[model samples]
Target: MTLEETAILGCALQWPDESLPFLTEAGIRADTFSHEIPSAIFTAIATAWLAKAPGGFVGIATALGDRLDALGGAATLQTAIEGAAQPVTLPHYAEIVKEGHSKRRLALALKAAYKQLTTEPTGTVLAAIEAEISSIAAGRDKARIQSTREIVMSVLGNLNSRTDGSKMAGLSTGIVRLDEETGGIRKGGYWVIAGPTKGGKSALVRYIVRAVALDQAKPVLVFGLEMSSDDTVEAMLATEGKVSASRMRDGTMHEMDFPKLQAAANNLALAPIFFRDDVYDLAGIRSYVRQVKAIQPDLAVVVVDYLQLTEGAGSADRREQEIAIVSKALRRMAKDENLAVIALAQLNDDGELRECRAIGMDATVQVTIEMCEDEPGARLLRLRQRQGKTGVVVPVVFNGETFEWHPLAHEPEPASGKSFNRKRK
Candidate 1:
């Protein structure tokens, strides 16, 4: 063994508080203690002695000494320890001391010592360890990636499946033509409903939640970041009862809507839908989705009212960066958990609202709903299916009184005007 190793072993052998001073007098530094072998190898030995010692330094040192002498003669060991106390200056020692043992510097020191003793290139040694870790990680990631792809494929395949030749689940809103064009919300596929401020995104989401959860009995989870749980519930009740959200909040339902309100409340209470208003962080949302899935293994759908409201691990340079991180995470969670995740996003500065052209989504299908006074009470839901197809626009009408989405009775012809006449002929 090298002189350094011998000294470390000696220190490790002598652990008692009384003996610690002798080690210091012998020139060993106490605070620089490390359990790393060869370099901090003595520290590990000292710790092991300390674990056995009851009172303090004295008992530990005694126990350690006993083990060392049994392995070799004390005189021979002393020879090995004689010149081992040469002082060596460590870079960033002050910073390391300030940061404590777990800092990166300490880790690097131990790693360097290990590399030197093993006579291996530092990069090669690190790569070997990393390769082992990466190998295990790759296996796990491969499984996850495959499973996610399968879930998305399954959902899409089911939606387009022709065995029954009927729509799987109709769009919750009254927009019939829109429903016919896009085939109702497909399972396992992500849907983005984005628009500008005051575009009634929240209202539109509430309508879908009520339709799917209450009316259709599909298990849905809504991550309501923009609104409180109570407010979400109230809005849902309003949509269900065919009453204005204001009336529901005020507890003043019209006599005509009383029966509908009662039924809606009953439906909501029994629905399998779960709402989580507390999930504001992106990581928290990911965790909650896992937890929800654990309970409802077959959870069909998840909805985030709007993506911009969600927070990530830390604030970024701009809102766009934050949204990008959140968007990627949400898409990952969707595929990982095998559930359809529908997230609402806001439009850019430009007034143009189209699904395929919508910015910020890395995965899943996107649909933009443009609300304008010219198209009063009507929402133009532009459908852009990225994985499959694109360029399909369907006009949908929102019934103010019923709080429902209905497809326009007549499908709007393309702006080209040629298609309309071609169809007529």
Candidate 2:
């Protein structure tokens, strides 16, 4: 028998009440004990304790009766008594047994998956394995409780590390006033960038990618579901080189733009901005994120161009249900991976989300972008913010030629018939 099994059994026989909490917390059951004697002894002890009977070694042995006699009766009891672990260390010993149990459970699950693989469809097998794994993780998290002091210390750590309240606590979007209002993009944040079709949502995300990855020298992953990877790259190149996307697309770039385009390409070559335009579902996105995180631990953010375009698991028949699943999965992924997720979404003129309202509710920050009726570019309105005020609209300047956007720089107009603020490019 392993020392852990022996320790747990000994504690259960001698100090049932003391070991109960650890056993309960660890979710250890009688079947978890490796040895038959230990398992039986633990079962008897637990039964006696639950029944309000005296649960000492003798009491447990009596309760066990012939089962103990078959295992050597008094001598077995004496051995367990002599080898009893310290009462103070019961929890530690329980953890050891719990870890072993977890490993055994995983092995069993793998075996079951392997058996099913021969007869089941690949997707079913994979889903079964994933479900089991998720269940294990969920069980652990459910059992683990964080104290208020620990949470407070975590909050304090975040607060103490930031010298400026107005600055972003996480990755900066590179817009000064917007950063001040939204406190910048943060890890575990679910941000929705909503706008009408072709209303500069992609341009905004491109700027965000440049700000977070290129300018700040961090890593970012983009899931460009709406466009091909090459098209995404070209758009970024135009934004970076300050060239016209149309000119680049038609191979009609001016002679003077060659050097600028080359420079932009070189900068992008060195930038740690990763892109994948082929992912069409949430599982694919999650798998890709895991792969990227494994290779690039410093990955700071994940941008998905238009959430409604992505599919969900196979069972979701309705679009809204599919979107709900995707939204929850994306949010869970952000928290699980500890990264900011900026997912682009589409909004109608009535200000309702295009596919699912769940995205609006699930998002940590909901921002709507619309073209300024009186101006040239778009205005970003904070529809909802978890940590800040909403309804704040910030003017944005979009360079049509470059497909880049930034805060509009307001310039004072001279006293005239039509006095107005104009944004200089």
Model 2 global lDDT (CA atoms, 0 to 1): 0.76
The list of candidate 2 runs beyond 4 A from truth reads 1-151, 161-167, 409-425
Note each model's CA RMSD in angstroms: 19.1, 21.0
lDDT tens string, model 1, 1-425? 44344444443344334343233333333333343333233443333332233422343334446554444434544553453332222122322322342243335645655765577666655554454444333422123112355689977876676347655443443345545555666655677777777666777777777667666667788888888767777777776776876666576867877887788778777677777787789877877665455334567788997787788778777666667777777777777777777888776545433222323345456666666344567766666666544656666776664566766654543332322112211
Which sections of candidate 1 miss by over 4 Å? Answer: 1-176, 249-252, 352-360, 410-425
Best by lDDT: 2
Instruction: State every prediction's TM-score relative to the real structure.
Output: 0.56, 0.61
Clashes of each: 19, 0
**C-alpha lDDT score of every prediction, in listed order:** 0.57, 0.76
Number of the top TM-score candidate: 2
- Evaluate model 1: give its TM-score: 0.56
